[model samples]
Target: MKYKVFVAGSGGIGEAAALLLREWCEFETEIFLGDVSEENLAKAKNFILQNSQKTSVVETILMSKDGTNEAMKSAFESCACLLDCSPGTQAPRMARFACDFKMHYANLTEYVAETDEVIALAKDAETGFVLQTGLAPGFINVLAMSLYRKFVEQFENETIEKVGMKVGALTAHAHQPHFYGFTWSPIGVATEYVKPSRVVRDYEIRQIPALSDRETIIIGGRTYEADLTSGGAADLPDYFRHKAK
Candidate 1:
């Protein structure tokens, strides 16, 4: 059915997501893009309209930190879902608004504390809430689960020794001293690198230093380095706690 979606950010990820929804959604969509900056809102709206199908109905809203503005309130009440692509710190606030409006909520924040807050806020709610729906925390976790399921089916055994999940966002060109370029926020990369990673060790959840378990591996006949980054495991470690080692 045709529905409305309220997107809470106007950054790169926000614009890209809106474009994908408008171009590929099965039903006609009405999207309200909200942000604090007028420049960003205009840019994001124009970007989506230029790339999406002709039937796309895109509008912009000026959002506040507390979500108290009349325009923001109207959009929230109208939309069926809130897609939060804002900064990680804004996760809980957006989640509160979603719960208050009784709309399905989804976000891409990898911040553990913020994610925990969202979980607590929506634990008893009737509507749906999906957290950490980003690349490493989202896609990689799903892929790991799929691989585990396939292995169990083929081997007919549940005593799995190990399930390794890794991800790297490498730049095409690199130099020494760090040998990395920024595809994402530098602060985010640094935060994940230094934070403790949640892992399953000996059928128990353990917190280990990020970048401590570094190794080299070959993929497609080319050698590359891999390491454990914080929050990438998502909820897999918890799910497989007693099921796999």
Candidate 2:
């Protein structure tokens, strides 16, 4: 059986996901790439088709900011899942659509407020809702939790001292003034910088301003600067509050 999947953005992440699903998903899938921009949707469709290695079908839809487009609604009604790769600000809207359509939902947004809204909306949903599924909050959080679990098992200890999680996606070389190149959404980067970070400090969860604590570190014999950023903690601040400091 071929599953229908809806992708809610045609930008970098969304396009990449569509391509990946087309090429790598175990089950056959039909991907519908939706974006506010027809130009982007066309480009993404071309890219996916050119690079696809499977026989999955790829389609496109024009999604409005409010997500009330009749065409988009028709597409949503057929899909079994919606992968939200749109801006973090749009997560709640996409999640609502998922709920209304009775489809499973997954999102890559690290926006805390929008994520919370989705969580509340999906709490009683029959389908599943996955959020904060990008590298920092998703992968790093899982990796840290696994390591902590292994550490506890290895030492035969029920609790630990401190747990620190950090992640950075950087270019080969960064110049002065932002020290960053635009590999992903600049707006998302700005949002992370301005939002407060949630972390477990002294065995309790606390909110601190982004970049409030800066430190110098050496990785692979290269010295670099690091600081606190928002949304990367995932649920660790709550999960490990009593177990780690």
TM-score of each: 0.93, 0.95
Please state the error at residue 118 of candidate 1 in Å: 1.2
Give the per-residue lDDT digits (tens) of candidate 2, residues 1-245: 78999999999888899999888887899999999999999999999999987867889998887648889889999999999999999888899899999999998877888888999999988899888888988988888889988998899995888888778767889988888977668899898889999888788889999999999989999998899988878777889887887
Tens digits of per-residue lDDT, candidate 1, 140-204, equal 88888899889889999877889888777678899887888875556667878888999888888
Q: Which candidate is the best by lDDT?
A: 2
The models' CA-based lDDT, in order, is: 0.87, 0.88
Give the least accurate 10-residue stretch of model 2, judged by summed lDDT.
62-71
Residue 83 error for model 2, in Å? 0.4
Off by over 4 Å in 2: 173-177
Using TM-score as the measure, the top candidate is 2
- Model 2 lDDT at residue 172: 80
Model 1: worst 10 consecutive residues (lDDT sum):
182-191
What's the number of clashes in each of the models? 0, 0
Model 1 — TM-score against the truth? 0.93
**What lDDT score goes with residue 30 in model 2?**
99
